[model samples]
Target: MNRLALLLAGSAVLAVATITPASASTASAGEVDTVTSCGNSGLQSGLSTRLCAEVTGTTVEFYGTVGLAGPPSPGGPGPAPKELITTLSTEVVGSGAAPTQQIAHVLFTSANLQVRGSAATVPCGSTVRATFGVASFPWAPRPVAHEVVITC
Candidate 1:
């Protein structure tokens, strides 16, 4: 009975460790890291335009805020905020490191809010703090977003 109990306990521990998600993993020496730099920068609004090429590290997170520009509510109409449909596309650039990209559809209706975004692209031997995507709503009238390239 003692032998059987110990065997079951060990099996359960192994299963639990293997099932844990990467995001849930504990931060350790070899686990989490970050790098920041100046990502793509420009003004975007009206019609449809996109900003790209920005890079940042996976471990690094960027944050920023965005506010409505131009004019205020004509008559303080409904209390509900306006909604803007925006798309975020991210991908790694160049060789030396693994390639990774992700896209997300975001809806912005808040007049002001902080954004957080991250990307990763770190070469084996390089030293520089750069920007990943800025943590600002890309749909804002005037948004200055940065990008992230994550590496360990």
Candidate 2:
């Protein structure tokens, strides 16, 4: 894995683990900020897509899932992919998300599509608005993008 991916992956473990209820202390560094969106019409192909992001401290950890809407079971076999996409691309972009305002693209080959990455540091209480984009897939007219807004 590249350095950036490795760093973000490692940070995910800590960010997800350190989440705690907001405390009264002003020295807050790990208060949790989270958001999830799923089962919406914005998706295609009868797809059940879920986007979640947990921001703890100055780190942002995100994960997403894509599968048929009514799978027999969680992560169960969904309809066969109508087309073979060797690589699927995804990213998280938002205001105050990056210093350069550039999005980070992460590649995936698995259907799980669950990914996590850290973004640029911003002060607490700064409105963090992000759009999680999943590359177009089989039977989908275009890529799917889900917007999430939360405070960190």
Best by the TM-score measure: 2
TM-score of each: 0.35, 0.42
lDDT of 1 by residue, 1-152 (tens): 99999999999999998899867765575643433344444434422222433333333333433344344557875334434433333323444443233333344453554444464434544332322222234444443444433434
Q: lDDT for every model?
A: 0.42, 0.46
- TM accuracy, model 1: 0.35
Residue 17 of model 2 has an lDDT of 64
Model 2 stretches astray by more than 4 angstroms = 1-42, 72-78, 82-111, 135-152
CA displacement after TM-score superposition, residue 59 of candidate 2 (Å): 1.7
User: What does candidate 2's lDDT look like per residue over 18-82, in tens digits?
Assistant: 78544544556655654444323345444555555555555554455555455356676644543
Q: For each candidate, how many residue pairs have backbone atoms clashing (under 3 Å)? A: 25, 0
Q: Which parts of model 1 have CA positions greater than 4 angstroms off?
A: 1-43, 46-58, 62-65, 71-75, 78-80, 96-101, 118-121, 124-152
- Tell me the lDDT of candidate 1: 0.42
